[model samples]
Every structure is written in C-alpha cells, then in structure tokens.
Target: MLIVTGYVQVEPTELAQFCNEFSALATATRRRSGNLSYSAAVDDPQDGRLLVVEQWEDQASLSAHLEAADTVAFVDRWRGRMLGNIEKYDASNKRGLMD
Candidate 1:
C-alpha cells in the first residue's frame, strides 16, 4: 500500500474555491479502481491550511491516479493558488525492507 500525508495553505478568501475543486478531485479519485482511501481536512480556520491523507493500492496505482483526467484538471486549474508548502510522505521503510 502507499500512504500520502501532506498539507497546504492558501488564502482564507480562496478557501471555498480550493475546497470546491479539491472535493471534486477527491471524490473522483476515491472512485478510481486503485484508490484505497482519500481525505482532505482544514486544520485551522484562520490559517486556511489544508491537509490531505491518502492511501493507494501501490505505487503504480498512485501514479495512475496522478495521471487521471480529474487530477490533471485540478492541477492545471489551481496549481498556483490552491497550495502553499505542500509536503508528501510515505512508508517505504515501514516494513524494514530497506534496513
């Protein structure tokens, strides 16, 4: 499985715009064949910070999802205004295979 944990910040006034697109993207992604789980949360009202948690069946699934049309639209539409300081993470070494 693949896990992605990350967060981003945007202008408070743009929250609705971000949520609209993000929610749509999340909905579409969750319905995909290889998507196991997906979620995006707003942690602070004043900060306008958004956090996303996602799980995929594997790296291939994640890559495929990234290439999906909806995802492409989301990125092309809001690549600049929707995110600030986004971070991505995974558990590649969790099973100790790298050790």
Candidate 2:
C-alpha cells in the first residue's frame, strides 16, 4: 500500500471554490482503478488550509492518476494559489496497531 498526505493553503474567500472543485476531482479519483481512497478536508479554516490524503495500490496507479488530464488541470487551477507538499509513504510492511 502507498499513502499520500499533504496540505494546501488557499485564500480564505476562495476556500469554498477550492473545496467544490476538489470535490469533483475526488469523486472521479475514487472511481479510478487502483485508487484505494482519496479525500481532502479543511484543516485550518482560519488559515485557509486543507489537508489531502490518498491511498493507492501502487506507484503505477499514482503515476497514472497524476498524468491524467483532469488531475493536471486541477493542479494547474490551483497553481501559485495553494502552497503545500504531498509526501508518499510505502507501507509494504504493514502492521496492526491493535495486534
């Protein structure tokens, strides 16, 4: 499993628009092959920051998703307007905390 997490900063007034647009992207992404999960949430309303989380079956899936036209457009739409870095983690040696 691969996990991706990050935060993006948006203008306070533009938060609604950002969320609406991201909702469309998230809906489509969830239906894509190898996409385990994808979501975003308002992490800091006062700061106008949003947290993004995603789980993928593998690197290929992630690559394909990133290369998709819609995905490209989404990023481009938020370019310079949002600030953040998305980091990926490999969880091949997964474990249960409750185990």
lDDT tens per residue, model 2, 32-94:
999999999998888899998999999999999999999999999999898887899998877
TM-scores, in order shown? 0.81, 0.94
Task: State the lDDT at 17 in candidate 1.
Answer: 83
lDDT, model 1, position 70 = 83
What is the overall TM-score of model 2 with all chains considered together?
0.94
Candidate achieving the largest lDDT: 2
- Note the Cα lDDT for every prediction shown: 0.80, 0.93
Candidate 1 — worst ten consecutive residues by lDDT sum?
A: 84-93
lDDT of 1 by residue, 1-99 (tens): 678877777788888788888888888888888788899899875878988888887888898988888888878877777665544456555555576
lDDT of 2 at 28: 94
Candidate 1 backbone collisions, by pair: none
